[model samples]
Target: RNNQRHSNNDARRPPKTFMPTNGASRTSRKELLDLIGNNPGGHLDESSRFKFETKLRAYANTPNVDPSDVLFAIGSSVYGTNISFPVQEQTNGSKPSDEEEKETNIIIDFDYMKAFMKDVFLSYGVKPVHAETCSEVLIEADRRGIDSHGFGRLKPIYCDRMDQGILWPDKPIDVIKQTDTTALVDGNLGLGLYIGPHCMQMAIDKAKKHGVGFVVVQNSTHYGIAGYYATMATDAGCIGLSGTNARPSIAPTFGVEPMLGTNPLCFGIPSDDDFPFVIDCATSVNQRGKIERYAREGKDTPRGAVIDSDGIERTDTEGILKDMVMGKCALTPLGGAGDAMAGYKGENISLIRIELFIAISLGRGLNCVRTKCISVHHFKSDDEMRSKKKKSSWDIVK
Candidate 1:
């Protein structure tokens, strides 16, 4: 009887399906939609959607299990039952495949990641305050799902440059010129991730006192994300605007060689709703970072987003990265390659963003094009204005 009972238990044991795999898992559109509960209203925006898909694919590929199978296992475990799955046999003591090795990733806590980044910056002589600020900004990008601008950028964009002595850490931001409501700053070639918040804060302060503020920074490195500075003003009950010109990578409409940065224009406005109104994007059809992301994932950029030297649209992700840096490829404008899509309009917008700071300073009769800029505007609400008027009139009569 005891032998028979043991046999029955063995017969009912669930088979293991989990196995190490060689390649990164790819995600289907169907799986993505399902993860979001198939709710149209819950669909992610373009950038967020790409990030979500990328992360999902990375996770799915990490264990080399079919996404559905993973889901099935979870469901079965939740319902207190074991599901059987066929297991692949592997040779004893076999080394992990190259693809599997490449797919492996270490999962770290958010705080630990920030601490590590902080140490990296500190080791390079960044000021304690600046190091914390920079680390927070990068981590915030990851938290907000903007992976392209987040922690992933620390090495390539900031630290590596610092190590090469190309990026100066702990440099003072000098005020080259200033008025009650406007100023010109020189970043001393320091990390813009640190300089950006400082300049925006100066603008916000001036706006509170003078109703508007305009601050510009010259000789600055790439600021992490333009929207971050813009939202700073909105947080302070003011309208915020920010933009920057990068090393040129965009070609004007009907032309092939690069002449414009994938210049971004960002705006933030206070609202009565739960979230502030914010608009932030590159004037190009797609930002270059997205292409880098596609290349990292071994995927092609969407069709028509870039053109090679031959003036032909290209989708070769890795090739495009090489070509663009060598000036053999160019990003399209917001409307895309040609006039049928009104690409010229996007070209016009790009020019506007670059010219905005120059024009504003020029209109104020200052010939200072050396600095990139940000602006802030504050206004009194109608009710407050009415109340102030009533009080002023009463005081005048008295």
Candidate 2:
């Protein structure tokens, strides 16, 4: 029976997930759990099996996940679940208590993490310089506090895609057309990490010469984070702006199926501060990456962030991700689910750019298949500063 099979191979599962950062490779997990919980072992029961498998799959999917991240990610699932590991080791021994152990974070050095990721890319036959460039972009997400798009994406977004033949890490970038201030490029299914920088640098170079530049890329896959490209322009002392289109996940205001990607937009303005003033966000209220992070944490997606096939708000992160990719569910737009808060505005903002890019690119020469958008918003002159302790200067006009 299925029940008997579930009981057979799952007994060692819990203990086998010992945190690697604890230097515990020499100390097997079974021994630790035995010491802590009287060597308890049994197959996962049907009810708890669902929870256990969910957490286990997430753990297996993200192998290189940092121990610090896993502390919160699988910590609660491990300690509180009824499947196994019933007791926590005490502070009586030289070993630290569960509380202290949870706080013990083995942080990865930034350079080391970058070097490791570069090696991962290189292993896939990426050119050394291109691999390094991709690594830098992925690491910058962590540096900028965008955990959703950081190294967590490596296996699923890059390595797995490469494995499945969805991404070509070694393809050359082709410039389809070029003008003094504009360009159309084809990534040839290349790594977005390489294509993104190459395109942004071209834009930056043109900006230096002409005060503005426009570059559109097609056939690229996920490009790490949008902020990385926008910041590149800031580093060059020019206002940097960029966006990327991704696989569709967002639905229209009243529609049920997905018709738009998360459609992130990011820009960086040089400022007097230590870092440039940068704004980066997906047009959807909850982007797919954030949902993936939640799934990794064994947590539910935020309510109203996603909608299922029945037109109901869905909170199951894993299910929503699966359904969205399959067109059975869709993400709510930036404002929320309905027109009550103008969610359609967000839906339009994310979708129209893709059409515009494709049309423009195809009209010129090659087809535009990339997923990002960029546009300017202008504001009229307004009142000057007012005291923070009092009403604003604009209040007088009102």
Candidate 3:
């Protein structure tokens, strides 16, 4: 939902070269076989499998290779790595042609890919732990085939946000409130990527004791993936739920200007295995990423994603931007434009998100007051009550 990073870079650029080849290119049976054979474990871990795949697609559009030929070539090489062929005998009982033999060849080097991504994140001023987690999340998404939220976003997120003060390096998250099953976190203008995970951990601990725990936070920047926070609870044997309010970019049904954010909700339920049913998605039918995707594939937007200056549905990219920035055209909710298409449901969810944001803000205020209170007359009777109460050391806002 947060496309603030890459979507604006075209206005000032070094005219970078083409993107790298993606794994989606027609992968040969041979390559799959080689990868399978060489990596007998089958790229199954969170970091090795999913994250690696996510990084691959990002490479496809980077400034090193032709996007068109990369996938195809990689696919052919894949076929060479793992395919089986039936040999034919000539009158002389000859061997198969090189083309047939090529179907069983192998040609990828994974270490280089890892190094490439590492260099990229480090260059963006990401703290080592943060960069590692970011890379893992992206590649894991790719491996799981969720290309929509993978490494394709890494460069913009770390580098661009650092420039904007949206992502800070090594800033400690300030905790403003804490209780048994609930707390409020002030990110202190730090990266939500780090603060979010920390907050979720607090919730997980509380849930272990109270059956359910929830934490609402504010002033946190965009966390890369919502699933990352929700899954933390499920991983610890409890159902996990996490949601965040983002900068406004989505329009409520029937409204032209953006008022509600593309607020995301994520739920994680643990199953028998490691692959839990974790759903991470935005409230909007289509997000800023989807818009950029249309521009990337040279395709038109689907109906209902955006409206023009005249309040009519439109697919033109420039027009979409005009409506987004100047024309007051905004993104619709999960349902289509009107009540007939379930637009009301989207509005209902928006209200829920708004309530969560408000609850967190209010809760923080209450906690701040509690920090400044004392036992008063119980401690020193009437004499202590007459003295002016000292201000709380942690109450920065007051």
* Best by the lDDT measure: 1
1 against 3, candidate with superior lDDT: 1
Off by over 4 Å in 3: 1-118, 321-323, 354-398
Instruction: Write one digit per residue (lDDT tens) for candidate 1, span 27-96.
Output: 3434543654443322114554454445454555455454334433222211112333343335875666
Whole-model alpha-carbon lDDT for candidate 1: 0.65
Of 1 and 2, which scores higher on TM-score? 2
lDDT (tens digit, per residue) of candidate 2 on 93-145: 46566657644434444576677678767767899999999989988887666
Which lDDT tens digits does candidate 3 get at residues 32-103?
335434653333233444433544444333443342333333222221111122444557789868876443
TM per candidate: 0.67, 0.70, 0.61
RMSD of each: 17.6, 14.8, 15.6
Estimate every model's Cα lDDT from 0 to 1. Answer: 0.65, 0.64, 0.53
Give lDDT: candidate 1, residue 345: 90
What's each prediction's clash count? 1, 4, 26
